[model samples]
Target: MENAYKEIEKGYLNMELLRFTTAGSVDDGKSTLIGRLLYDSKAIFEDQMEAIERASVGKGEEEVNLALLTDGLKAEREQGITIDVAYRYFATPKRKFIIADTPGHVQYTRNMVTGASTANAALILIDARNGVIEQTKRHSFIASLLQIPHLIICINKMDLVEFKQERYEEIKKEFSKFAPKLAIKDIRFLPISAKLGDNVVDKSKNTPWYEGPTLMYLLENLHIGGDNNFLDARFPVQYVVRPQSDKYHDFRGYAGRISSGVFKTGDEVKVYPSGFTSKVKGIHFGDKALKQAFPPQSVTITLEDDIDISRGDIIIKKNDTPKIEQDIDLMVCWFNERPLQIRGKYAVKHTTNDVRCMIKDIEYKIDVNSLEKDYDDKVVKMNDICRISIRTTKSLYFDPYTRNRETGSLVLIDESTNETVAAGMII
Candidate 1:
């Protein structure tokens, strides 16, 4: 038991996390593919499997419907569709995975944007029989707009197309023509049958002509180490930690997740908005002291100088400071039903900074289908994406969304209702 426990702990420590989102048209097998991936990987518990089995029988399914595993909501199960973003977690020996199964309907495009916002990779499913359709282009455009590092185009439902290599090749060729227009760095194509478990977790004999890594293999082995912006060091202070206990009264640390780049002890740093200079005295992760901290790590840092630093302040290398500007240009994806009001005041949240901003102008709206910019149609509505300018009440420290996703993104909240109205990516 001791040996087994040690082996398990070692495996857990060595595992890398991969966050991916799945998207396709309605009935294109997004949920089913996730369910199949989980089931074949042996990640599903026996009791959970039995419950799904019972539900499948109640629905009069001839065979157990794997899609039922993810359609957990009563409305989703009744309508036979995914309405919201359904997140699922599973782990293989090689890596741990977080799957965001986004809705496929055109109305839920906002949900798709929210789901794929922080993803490292995107799994775009194309129905083999229908080939590349409009929804496929929409999702692909959003994936590129969000700057997801990897794109895996899974041509699904090979059983319907009789597992024909020609069909897969045709769809691949069609999508390749459109893929060049996007800004995605890496794009790969694969053929799979989610229902029959072909080329998902294991190699399928049905596709003898196709030779490629399985979906699971591609996800587990994809290179994501270079996806983060490591050159520009940025640390947004989320909280100012001060120990009140008598044991450690002198503790003053700024705690936040590293948004980008690297921070190390003894490095010269500057506080944003105040322009105060300081040296890093220490970096702490819980009770353990770390020599350095990088992106996505929540570590408490102590500076040599006791400056007036607080929440919403950014700390960075003195030489590589980000642009501190109040007027910003960005691409906005409107998420509310009410049309965006010109010159409207909305609360903007970026990183750890909060400020109110007003819409100055709508430069153009890009049609996701054709990638055309329309300067005439400025009325932005739900799911309408456009490029606009905004002037903030206070200066913001940010980079282009293409440069650093963590520092380059923000959300606009409706001041009256406190609802998030839109998500913006800085240009």
Candidate 2:
């Protein structure tokens, strides 16, 4: 299949990046768990470790707090609470990882949605001492609603609960009740002590009755390559590259990342809005032509015929076009401090297209903790996920979020300030 963005991308198509988010209630040791993963995986540099040690010394702590490694903000360091989503990067021989450690506080629930929006797996921390709290269910709901493939329930602070098998079972039992209502397909629960380093990297000597793969083992072995939508091909054109230089004067290229499915060098393709068909002449990364392209890859595609294609136009297979509708129903998480207005006019960003949209009607408000849909509440507040309908000025071609996150997901930006106010997933 012809991918339209193969002619204008950086040539080398060699690296892979995995985005995973850490979530849980406040004091659930999310930051500490991330530090443990980085430390145990031997991904931390000496300078980074030195800074952590110095920070520990300043706090007069006996041992360096591993959570300090990801909590880079001054307010988070001073208040001992994560205020914003903190991202950390590290790599192992098996895979490269990007950790989006989001705040566990309820008010910052919007941050968790932002972090987990693109995550393949979610690391949910549960404090053994408190068992399953209200916040536990909230994060789980968000992960499922976002259509994340895997959920790892890390029962943290196991040492404080004496590593008792019964206590762990109790918490697990409570969570199992609510798991049925979620969209999660695979769920695994583990007992861990983020503070004592139990069952995080290597197996623990403390939990003698428990035996399972360590957190690192699960992350390294989880099959995530097949997590993308293989049936639908959606590549939103980011830019049209045409160099006026001597050698490449006639070169025309469409540059963008392949959001889903696969693209081959000699397949026929179509461009949206204009509904023009073209054949794939050559698929190039920078200079070398590729045999094919897949999800999460950024490449430049050169077509056989020059058709009028520009930014915001999606390149997709002709027969497998998405449902184009002017109105859509979605679950939206309001992220703005300013209250959401009824029948408000905001710019809706779907894929690469931005159109003026109006909030038609709120179907219902979802209780994140209970996973219950409350239709009686029509008003959407900050951090609330309400099923809503939006009518756009132009029709948008989209698939369900479960099928294609790249095309099915969108954001609502305030028209005046141009700030993102909500994130939505098509239902």
TM-score of each: 0.97, 0.92
- Per-residue C-alpha lDDT of model 2 across residues 1-427, encoded as one tens digit per residue: 2453552232224335677889864477886788778887788889999999999999999988877887778988898877788888877656678988888877888999999998989999998998888898999989988998999999999999888999999999999988998898989999998888989888998888887888888887888878888778778888888998999998998889988888887778998888999876766788788988888888888888889998888889768888889989998999998878879999989888888899989888988877788989887888988889989999998898878889899999999999999999997
lDDT of 1 by residue, 1-427 (tens): 9998998888878999999998864488877788888877788999998998999899888888778888779998899877888889999988999988888777887988998898999999998999999889999999999999999999999999999999999999999998888999799999999888899989989998887899999999999999999999999999999998898798899999999999999999999999999999999999999999998899999999888999999999889989899999999999998899999999999999999999999999988778889989979999899999999999999999999999999999999999999999999
lDDT of each: 0.92, 0.86
TM-score, structure 1 vs. true: 0.97
Worst 10 residues of 1 by lDDT: 23-32
